[model samples]
Target: MTPGLINGHLHVSQHLLRGFVPLAVSDTSAYLFKWVFPYYETLTSREEGVAATLAGCDLLTKGVTMVADGGTVRHPGVVADALATTGIRAHLGGWSWDHASAPPGLSMDTTEALDRLSGAMDEVAGRHPRIAPLATTIGLGMSSDALLEGAKSLADRHGTFLDFHHSFDAGEVESHRSSFGDDVTPVEHLERLGILSDNVRLVHQIVSTAAELDAIQRTGASVVRCTGTRAARDLAELRGRGIPVGVGTDTVNVSNTSDVLRALHVFAAEIREPDSDIPSSGLSADDLFDMCTVGGARTLGVASFAGSLEPGKSADLVMFDALRPEWIPMIDPVNQLVLSADGGSVESVWIEGELVVDRGRVIGVDELALCQEAEEAAAGVLMRMGARARIGRRSLC
Candidate 1:
């Protein structure tokens, strides 16, 4: 038996909120402010719960036993209830975004936002033991660097974890470089702020420099590489440096299935630098498999309980269908899993000795209905904000 897949990063509510906004997938930031953040502002607690319920169901059925869900959860209790109902393990955060420069109608007072986050953490942490509390960062524009540092200290004292996006886009990279100058990158700024430690978990970290990588390694921080959303060379470099690199699908915006195995394959193949006098492949099949399970568990700081299939560990596992006819002889499960199999091959999923999915179907659920709700919710948000026309007008204007 093999251990179930550990998702190093996930955005449960963001799954439904994705295409309704224009962030990186668009050509301009106007759509983001005029449409995206306002749309998020309109998302009620109940809507987040629904999204979490549906997304959690999808993950478990795909053989993912655990996920580190990062976001500004307005109601942590509601999120925990959703996770418990779905029967999945999650590290849920009470998110905070207290930046004055943040888009209007979406910004919260810094102190008030922290108060809400703290209340949510207290309410949810005691009620849901499987759901760990984390301090998460939100907002696209520059906020008080001091707030980020303070949140890290708070999370550490609570014996919880910290998660944030780092250097995800070229524009963000440039913004950091221009603001901070040659003295440091945003990550270096984070390091100075005292958040660079084993408890810190970063999503993306795509455009960071080699020196910054060394700093993260020195501090024992972990990085969750969304291979489905990044260039391959970035993953390879991080892997070579002994950084705890795990695999994630990012969002349905980037990948429809959110399958780590497929993400690994896409990255492994994409990062190839044109074989040069090299006798061995840049990435091995086993390496990719380890990234999905062992690496992911380590990145999330849950290796002791979740990484591998061993006695005394929780019974979390996934069974894939037999090798395809093309792979007539099952040479290596690792190879087949990384290079050949998709979500279709997943036959069953077990989490904490409970069966959540069997025979390639989510137990006691209607996927079509879920899809309809997600689509309708997304369309409603877009329509309310006039996002389609707004995007076009912004381009024309």
Candidate 2:
């Protein structure tokens, strides 16, 4: 049997783009404004539901009982309902993008954005307690950044955590350097905004320097490593510092569902890059396992509720069929899981002592039907935007 897995970070709506586009968009600026927002603007609540439900159902099959849906579209409540229907536990966040000079198609009044997010949270919270909806602010992760302060205030008022993408890669670092003069990194910016608190759950953070890492450690803030998309060294350094870090699949851009096993294995392999002479002996398979299960729960501040299979904790457990050819030796179950297990191995999944998925199938979902709906939605939206043919075409040459 597999331990209950907590998907520390994910954006459910991104599931529709899984395997449909390139892994990473080359033209991030044009893609975000021209294609992403324009296409997303066409997304209906039902469409978002279909995407979240499909992704959540897949997580059930992968032994992932919990997920932090980092941010949702306009009607986040609809996404929450989809998760409830799929029998997956989720922390649904209502995202807010408020700035006068924000990117095109993303500008919204600060007060209006907050109001909408609050309304969405109240609506989702009233529907299901498992769907812990919170108002979130998205920023480039710089200290004292406008978005960071807003996230802190909103989180305090709602008793919820603020999720932000922090120091994703070298490109973001350069942007921060350009926006704020030298001698300041993005993490320091978050510190200045009073956002590096226990209530903050920063995602990615691949580019944080040693000093910033120490700063985050001092704040007692948790780091969520999207190992599926991040370089392995990024996660290993945090682990070495004895910092609290969790693993995530990080949207369909990396993979469809937030399967912790995939993330852990990738992280382990990545830590052994050629340039870095770091010995991989100390980081065992179990260490990676811990990062996905208990480690994830700790990052999300839900350890008391459902990290391990202790008697009193909520009985969120996953059982994988051990009869597969991948289990040839089967000497160590955890090791076998990381090396061989995929979403298909999940045989049963339980959440809060309830049988949410049994026999590798979500309790109340039709996989084929959901796929068809999602396909139709994607086509409809793409066509409506008058840019259907340019979906994944790039003029890199």
Candidate 3:
């Protein structure tokens, strides 16, 4: 059995948007404001719960036993309830913003935003005791300096982890430079705010400067590098700096897959030039595998509870069927696991000593029926948001 994989960054509510939205990698603002934000606004609490359930089921079947959710602002309780039912260990954060204006149709001022976040911290503790509270800064560019500081303060007080989006795309980098100044990058801004800490987990530090990278290393803060966004050189540099780097699939709308093995494969292969010497990358299959497991656990601040198979640790592990075609002639277990094997090789999964997936299927839920519901929910949401007309393709079939 392999140690259960952990997805260090995920958006549980955005699972329904998979394949529904066209990704415009160049125009981050249009993608968020036009498609993503509006679609989120259309979801009812029930729909959100259904989406979260679908996501959890997908991850479980893919041998992911734990996740750190980037919670939606509308109905985080719904997401918590779904995750609880699915039996996946998770740390959840609430929707938070203060500096920038709320997206269209959403009403939020700084006072209301802080108040909502404070209430969410208490709500998650009272309602979902298993789920830890994570200080959230929607994104560095979107969150004000006050909000960032407040989030860190909240995390410190609760002794929990802080999660937030950082420099993932060009638009965000431009925004950060414009908002703060030309000299100070987003990482420097975070350092100046005094929010960078060991408890902080910054997502997608793709465009960070040397000073910012220095700050991250000095503060002992971890980073979740999504395979879909960052290059191999960037990852090698982060690893060389002795930073605890974890792998994440990001959102369904972004990477479009919840498979950890696929992400692991990308992380391993993307770091080096095809013709270049492999030794130059300074990463091995073992290192990437550790990132998926123990490294991810560390980023989520649950290393003691999960990540590895050891005495006193939670009974979370995955059994890959070695007889499968993908596992045939597996001379190196780590290489096979990282470079070739995928969710299809997963025969069983156990989380907290309980079997959640068996025979390559999630046990408790009728996955097909749940996917059917997700489809209906997605269609309804798109229709309500009037985004169906904007869909690039006329027919999905």
Candidate 4:
């Protein structure tokens, strides 16, 4: 049994939007402003619940027992309710953005944004004690300085983690430099504001420089990198510097899958590219596996409670079927796990000493019915958002 894999970052609300957004490889702005924001604006609380349930069910079945949800600006209670039903451990919260250009009905001033986040935390903590609060800011470019400070302060006060996107694209870095009017990079800017810390977890960071990497290492801040972004060298460099690095399946519309094993496979292959100056012996299959298990747990600040098979730790682990064809020639266990196996080989999963999946099937949920529900929900949401017309169809379903 391996430690139950932790998804370092995910957006459950976007699960239904998989394949609905036609994204170009380099177009981050279109992925966010054109499709994601519009889709988010059209979601009701009920639909959010459906989406969350579908996401949680899929992740749990794939051996992800815990996730750190990058929240939407609406209906976090519905997210928590869905997590409760799926019996998945998660940190949940609402979006906190103080920018004037935020989507309609989603934008708030600094004070209002902070208040909304704090109130959501209190509400979720009181309503469902199991779901932890995740203090969030939209990002360095979109969030005001005051909002960033407030979000970090809130996380510190509540003893939780602060999550945000940072330096995910070169354009974002350029925009931040333009907005802040400083020659310093985005990571330096965050350092100047005292926002970088061990409790803060930044996502993407694909455009980071050496100085920024040093700042991250110095501040002890963690990073969650998505393999779909193809920033393999960045991930390896961070790991080499002894910084905590975790893997993430960004979003359904972005990475197109919640399978942690797939992310791990991509990460392993990318880091081992030929003709690289870095030695081939630098990263082993075991090291990549640790990134998904212990590294992810540490990045999420849940290492003491999960991550390993210790006496006092939670009994969270996955059992892969050794009898599968993928494991028939398993010469090196770690190598096979990292290079050959996918989520399909996951035979069973346990979280907090309770069996959530057995024999490759979720214990109680009716998956077939859930698929029907998800299809209906997806159709309804797309139609309501007027996104149906945007979908490019080449063949009849």
Regions more than 4 Å wrong, model 1:
18-35, 139-141, 228-230, 273-281, 323-329, 364-379, 387-397
Total backbone collisions for each predicted model: 0, 6, 1, 0
**Candidate 1: residue 374 lDDT (0-100):** 62
Worst 10 residues of 3 by lDDT: 388-397
User: Model 3, range 1-397, lDDT digits (tens) per residue?
Assistant: 8999998888888887887666555565667777677877788998999999998998888889988888677777778888878778777868787655556566676677777777777667656645777667687756777777887888888788888888877667877789787667888888888888899988887777788889999999999977655434366677788888887887887777888788877766665557643344557888888888998888877889788989999899899889988888979988898899987788899987899988988877877777778777877887788766344323222
* TM values, all candidates: 0.86, 0.90, 0.92, 0.93
What tens-digit string does per-residue lDDT give for candidate 4 at 1-397? 7889888888998887877666565476667677878888888887788888888888887889888888856888888988778888888787788888877757688999999988877767756645888898778867899999998998998888899988877777898888777588999999999999999998888788899999999999998887655556565677788899888887987778888888888877766777554344567787777777889989888889877778889899889888888887879887888888888888899888889988877776777777777777777778877767454333322
lDDT of 2 at 151: 60
Off by over 4 Å in 4: 23-26, 275-281, 389-397
Top-scoring candidate (TM-score) = 4
Ranking by TM-score: 4, 3, 2, 1
Q: Mind giving the per-residue lDDT tens digits that candidate 2 earns over 112-179?
A: 66666677677777588677866565556322355457667767786777787776678878788678
Q: What is the alpha-carbon RMSD of candidate 1 to the true structure?
A: 5.2
Whole-model lDDT, model 1: 0.71
TM-score of 4: 0.93
Q: Candidate 2 versus the native: TM-score? A: 0.90
Residue 214 of candidate 1: its Cα lDDT?
85
- lDDT against the true structure, per candidate, is 0.71, 0.73, 0.79, 0.82
For candidate 2, give the lDDT.
Answer: 0.73
Ranking by lDDT: 4, 3, 2, 1
> How far in Å is the alpha carbon of 34 misplaced in model 1?
5.2
